[model samples]
Target chain A: MPQQVTRLLIVFAVFIGMFLVAAAFLKPASFGEYGHYRGNAIKEIAAKEIKFVDRKSCANCHNDNSDALAGAEHALINCQTCHGPGYKHNQWFEQNKSRFMRQDPASGIWTVDTILVRAAKDIPEEYKLLKPNERDACLKCHAINAARREKVVRQIDVTDHYDVKKKCVECHPPHAPNS
Target chain B: MDPNYQHLYDALSKVEGYIYPNEIGLNWGILIVLYPYITGLVAGAFILASLNRVFKVKALRPIYEISLLTSFSFLCVATMPLIAHLGQPLRFYEMMITPHLTSAMAIFAFVYLWYLMAVLLLEIWFDYRKDMVIWSGEKKGVLRLIYKVLTLGVYDTSPKSVAVDERLGYIITVVGIPSAFLLHGYVGFIFGSLKANPWWSSVIMPVVFLFSAMVSGIALVLFIYMIISWIRKQKLDMKCLDSIGKFLFYILIFDFVLELLDTVHRVYTAEESFDIISILMTKLFFTLTIGQLLLGTFIPLLVLGYFQFSKPKDAIRKASYFIISILVLGGIFCMRWNVVIGGQLFSKSFMGFTTYKARLLGAEGLLSSIVIMIIPCLILAALLWLLPPWKKKNMEAY
Candidate 1:
């Protein structure tokens, strides 16, 4: 190669060097360990804070609600589906449980491990989580549409079924709707 | 309503039949159309430049350097649309950093770099090395400094060295022809390889794209050459323009035939996807039938073919060529639009059709595309200033 060609080659070589440097630094640490994706990402995702705990956790406090939900048409649905992620409630209640409840001195040596929260107003607005009523949660799955197949989801024609102003919960208590 | 989703909401009202819920908005909009269109121009311009160096076509020599510059300038701006269309434009380098080899889309980054750096850049540099050395001394101020730096400290302009430069540049041009084909043909293949879309998937797609690319690239260079010469008040080289028209006419015929063959094949077989594709054709009638086929391809063939039989007046020839170039250029753009947008208009279900209303503003909109198209012209203007391809200037420099 001529001196000029050699100089051009040097420029190309420098570019190759830059790309290699970029590859070394910019590439995710766990990339290509198992395949094209970051292998460690799976572990990282697994380690993330839970936003939806098991229904068993919700069942621990609301025995009557759980019993109603289990015996009703909404047996398959979990508390978190309508109430939003229960993990946030668990965290907020654990931190602010003192405002909601305290161990009774009358109970003496046999004190309960956890207190049940009942009052809706005592919870802070930020930690209130979701308490969907009427159309908000029910209409999401039941709204009549051409694409929403009958077998996949039961469609409700909101206009024809009843007065448009009437709440669905008035006729059908979501926890025990079939009753 | 959120401005981002307004188009989708509007499209929802126009939705016909049973398209998927996800198919409401066109993901690959006008920017994607411009992407292949621009790349085709770059590859086509390079091929036209190759006609001078590799094929030893004497008539093409006048526009040869300009062709290369046009290729270089457009090639530089080619990936702008693809990058800007990205949702996370900042992370776009991830395609380069950890490019998935199996992906046709990811592979474009390498292909683009190879064409720009190895083929076009190297060829242009070698061609201009001796010129840079001479002009470095002949000029002053920033341009002098620019030329001097461009020379890369090699001041040797011996007959042997100049001979070497020409020989090497010739070799690069020969190498560049296939790379140019690969550059644009690969684009065609990207669309063709998608088996899901009956409109796009065809073996003949790559060939059609390559020929159309050549047609468009040649037309663009021809248009630029005429415009620049007219602007400078230089007498237009009728022979060069005539040769361009002739080449353009031939290749465009091939391009049309290949496209027709694909369409005819689809029609003849009338496979499972035939009905929806037929509907797609009707939907794209204005752009496909009028713009690309009638105005862009057929008329250029008629006029340019007429030129071959008899010598028209120089003024008439020039005006006809200018009009033909514009028509051909616009036609190729419509061709890309049809392929990219037309393929998506109909659903994979072979049932429904969706509408695509191109946004007037925003990143992937018509305005952005027009702005991107202008950038290449601006770059070409800058390049023409720095590397004057005027025969008068070349003689003056020598």
Candidate 2:
């Protein structure tokens, strides 16, 4: 019995040792100075999600923007791009105090229309180039949000619905106050 | 269509039958589906091997090489489906080359390597080494060359060497048993981990997959064993096949019970996705439930059970076994299709469905899949020719 026990123990140890050696040898080959921690750190960054800003911050400047965006089913969208970087625009208008197209005298110099045109220009070309009547710009991101999307185009063609006809500005102004 | 589906149609109209974000394509679900099928083959083959090596079921001795060879063949083709399903198949080596050790998929890749090199190939070589020596001298031309290469330059045909080969092969077979389980069971874990997909989130998936694998494996071996015997004009081993049938009966029953239990649990709880799932059950899965579960699984089980216990004669029993085996294969395949493709048919919205049509040829087509499946059988045939498993000298001589 003692001999059997010792033999079993030795055999078990040998198996573990063999497994460990095989694992060590078969560790997959790698290249360059990008080793271990560095590689994992880079992977961690790559896996990091791209954040989308929320829509509430844009509403502070363009009070009626929300209502217009709501009509276009773009209530979920952030205003950074369409509003041409709200912080910088607001800062420039505040310092310059230009009264061009101002909706109110005491309010900053910029009016709703001037901001609308500027915001429209700053939009990415694909969204900006959408057919004026088509809801492509408004529908792209909002398509999955069916309830909101229905308020804007209501209906879309089969080919277009699956494609670019769904941009943000199709049914709403880039920067104008809501009607 | 149900009036409830009106809302679904309304939702579908907005996207115009397109997937959301463009990132979530058919690739993910397609890979998920193939995972179970491949793993099931592995499990089935291993179980067949176990019957001979572990349990010492003598009648199944004929199928001993075929089962190991089938497992090896299937493992070779298993990853092809996954590779075809990848958006970037070229970058797939990264899955193994630079594994995400934390991920279950990474662990699975390692497991695959372990089984391929350590389990299947080694055991198979050990089993066939004796035969390879015998054939190395007899054949000429391509067969001679093939035999020479396969023997790893070994010329030994001594009794002592054969005994050593048998002992080593036995040890490998014992080790391979768990590796086989891991191969299939991990697929279940993959689906079960996706908490976001309520359709897949369940602990029972792994257990169900394992048992279904056993059912499929046993049925497949029974089918092939009969065909091979018939082809060779060899005497049919009725007793051995009856034992196989009995095992298949138990596993198929276990699989059916688990599936029923899962459905009952889901229906009873009426989870958040229950409404949509019930609709799916009544609609898309109706054929699967009725045809596969009721007719395919249960009827075959009854037939197999009756034949095994009643002790029918060689001819009648053989015919019934063939029919039951075919039914078992069909039933298990339906189970896979339901678990895999069925889960993806419905949209995340739970209101709409999208269709998938497998192409006949080219990449991601039915033709390629068929070719992949056939390659293994061809390899096995070549192996049998080289090994000449039927000869008395090549036999285990228990």
Candidate 3:
């Protein structure tokens, strides 16, 4: 019994010892570098290039559209909310300015790069640009549910408000939707 | 906008009611369903082992060792689905190292570790230690060395040493019962405490989970025991089988009643989320009404109840128990599915519903789920090979 107890202790010690050694190896080197989580994650995130260019950059080129949007009820909404991201569009224009100048309207020859247009079809759903005529774009925010939103400026239940197929832009313009 | 972008507009056209755009994609999938189901098995199997050890139910003696091993096997893989479901599985250790006290999720690492390391593993080691030591001396070659290593130098077969081992094992079993309850009950609390989701926010969630866990775990062990006995061409312990069936019958009744009560309360309250929930329930009619309630619970209950009252031949009883066990397992699994997946089907805004289309591939897909389910069975088979859990007479004959 004494020998058995001694053996059990030895076995338990070995198990505990192995566990500690494994844990030491498995633990990240920068584990406690910050606090609890791996500190390297902060560095990794910091190293990535910024993706969403702020609304201020869009105002530089399409000042008229920005001015119209700013005067509307949807003033708080960012330009990218409808136009999609401007970074790639801005980059394309900067790289291919000469192509924009070489277009001939009579011959229907436009040398402009397709990428510069920010085609809604080409982009992913998350970053897709909304056209002025798309009623669903307005409906994304305006589609009525008292349960979901706190202060709904105007809510429209699409089924009851108008012809089922009619676009919102047919009556209300996109830039100043309520106007 | 490009004409190709029309599909994006069409996507939202199908939405009948208002759903938060962010809520369109379900974060919890089939893998989350698996998490509770697996953990429930662990708790259930452990509780069954306690029936023999702590309660001293002599009829349950045969499955006592298998139940402990079954619990250990499932417990080992129980957390895999949880880790797999994480956005960053590599950062999972952070939950353990730096636990947030306010977060219900953070409690998981502690509860799981305590149950695994302290209760399940320790109890299993103590229970098997004497047998391992004996087997170590009796065997030769790789098997002998493996047994020797498992014994952990405890070669004491002395009556006094075994008495001490027995006493300690009893203590661990007593400790294990509550720990088992805590293990699965804590899982229930993780979902139940989410005040945002009306479906999961109920006090009865933990009780429902605990009883269902007992039902599933007992069913699994019962089925596995019957199958193993049949494979070995050994005489099925009718007494033991009947006792387990009886326990399963009683537990199933409790589980069914609690589930019905929860449903009744939700329907009667007619809360703001009630209408949407009603629609969601109708949509899930096949899985909830027919699969879980009818096929899984009620039918099995009726059959098991009949067995309780009537005296049947061993062959007939065994077949009935086997079929009923399978049904009970399916029923419990459906209950878990209903809780995890069904809870997410309705929008938190109480305005709409979304569908969960389980992918056949990917990390948390159906393929992965099937593979995960098979893994524990494989582990059990391996454990059985390493340490055969049978009586001395059966062992010698084999």
Candidate 4:
């Protein structure tokens, strides 16, 4: 081999060696352990507490609202789907449970304060609740458009059905929108 | 709804057409616009280099070395915008290590690496190795040490070895031509393959991108060459400038025609997306019509066309070329802006539109783009000082 070619080979080999060494150290610990991506990512995600309060939790306290929604158009929809996550609201209730309970004098029974529990409207800012009657919250599902299938649900063109500025809940209540 | 909720209702009222709730925010911003623009320059500069080295265009010889260096300088920063735009820039290397073949994005890392390592770096090294060896011997101090390291211990500058180097460099240029096309064409493919976007999903996207790359690349070289010559107190190469202008004119026409054809087809077909697309064109009337087509393309075309047919004074010709090159560059940037941002402007539902407002600061903002743009010029200056691509008396010693 020519002297220059030998030198070139040596330089190329050094570069390759450097790259391999760097790659060995810099690669993620769980990378390629199972598949191409970081295997630890699945566990990292699984470790997070569920943030959205399930429908059953909301229904346990608001049976009237749940019953109103049961046979309505949004029967399958989760409470947090539109109202936003309720994990913090549940946490707040747990922290202040004593304030929301008292002895009923007539029945001589200890009862939960329905007024404090039912007023989900006044949840703390951390709960990130969607304000009731907000057009965006309702339009997210109810806004009529050509994109949604005709058979899926009756879609309404906001302008054609009523004034563009009017909210869907103005005429139709959310729990029983059809009524 | 209660009257108290009117504030929220008013905010939602800004949306004029049907847009996917997710599409309301324009995900790709000015940074995405800069990605293709920077990459196009790289491809363009490389193609210009190939014209001189492989095609042996004698008039273009003056720019061959400079163009190669320009391509290298820009290539170094080409992926900066992309990496910065990523949510997790630290994991950018993951694309290289475990590429998903099914995704178009997965291919970018491989393509960028192949072009940078196999094509550009190798070609530049072969071209400059002899010079480095000579400079190492002639100079002293830090510069000498740097050149010595660059030589990689290949001190031989024999006629036979130089001939072999030339042969290898020529082969790389030949290979680089298509690689240049692939580099920018792949950018187009990234957009073109999106069946969901009517504006981007065109068969001629790669062709349009390739020709426009040529147009902008040629114009940039001509512009830079003129500026550099003036700064050095050297006479402008009128023949070279004229030839570049001629090439730019022809390629601009082809690029314009391809875009026009795509528009015409969309109009004639009048698909479900046509109405929305027409609205988009109207919304982009200033950018697509005035900035890109009229000012960027047509006016430059007419000026260059006149210059081609009639003999003008050297000063007048030089001034015209400089101004026209700037316009063409701006026009090409507008084309890229239209493709990247315009494609995302309208909702996938083909019913609504959103606006992109670039910030002066922040990660993907105007400030960052301005900084990104300046980085290449700085790299070019450094590369020029280190290698000095221009012919100097000391280079003859090799």
Give Cα-based local distance difference scores for all models.
Answer: 0.86, 0.67, 0.81, 0.82
lDDT of 2 by residue, A79-166 (tens): 6544333544444434444443456668656454545444544444432221333343333433344333355434544334444535
Of 2 and 3, the candidate ahead on DockQ is 3
* Fnat by candidate, in order: 0.40, 0.00, 0.28, 0.24
Candidate 4 regions exceeding 4 Å error are: A1-6, A32-35, A57-62, A81-174, A177-179, B1-14, B392-398
User: What is the C-alpha lDDT profile of model 1 across A31-129, one tens digit per residue?
Assistant: 889989899998999999889878887876566688999867788988888888888777776676556555667865533234446544576776666
- List the lowest-lDDT window of 10 residues for candidate 4 chain B: B389-398
Real interface contacts reproduced by model 4, as a fraction: 0.24
Best by DockQ: 1
Structure candidate 2, residue pairs in collision:
A98-A109, A136-A165, A136-A166, A136-A167, A137-A167, A137-A168, A138-A167, A138-A168, A139-A166, A140-A166
Per-candidate TM equals 0.89, 0.73, 0.81, 0.84
Candidate 3 chain B: 10-residue stretch with minimal lDDT: B1-10
Per residue, candidate 4 scores C-alpha lDDT tens digits across A1-179 of 65555776787789879877877777778987788778999999999987877787777567788999999987877888777788777777777677778788899897667676776465567854565686656765555543355577666654466776777788888888877
Residue B270, model 4, lDDT: 95
DockQ of 1: 0.37
For model 3, how does the per-residue alpha-carbon lDDT over B1-398 read when each residue is reduced to its tens digit? 33443543454554557677667667899999999999999999999999999988989988987898899999989999999998999888767655667778888888998898778877877777778888888889999999888776678778888778778778888999999999999999888888899989999999899999999999999999988888878888899999999999899899889988998999899899888888988888888898798988889888889889996888899999999889888888888898898898777878777667899999999999999999999999899888787733233433
What's the lDDT of the predicted structure labeled candidate 2? Answer: 0.67
The DockQ assigned to candidate 3 is 0.20
Kindly report the docking quality category of candidate 1.
acceptable
Q: Clashes in model 1: which pairs? A: none
Task: Report the C-alpha lDDT of model 4 over B1-398, residue by residue, as the tens digit.
Answer: 43434533553554566566566567898999999888899999899889778888877777777888889999999999999999999888777656778788889888998899879988988898888888899999999999988888789999898777788889989999999999999998998888888898988898888888888888888888887788777787777788788778788888889888888888899989898888888888878898788878999989998987997999999999999989988988898898888888888877788676788898899999999999998998898889876643323321
Comparing 1 and 2 on lDDT, the stronger one: 1
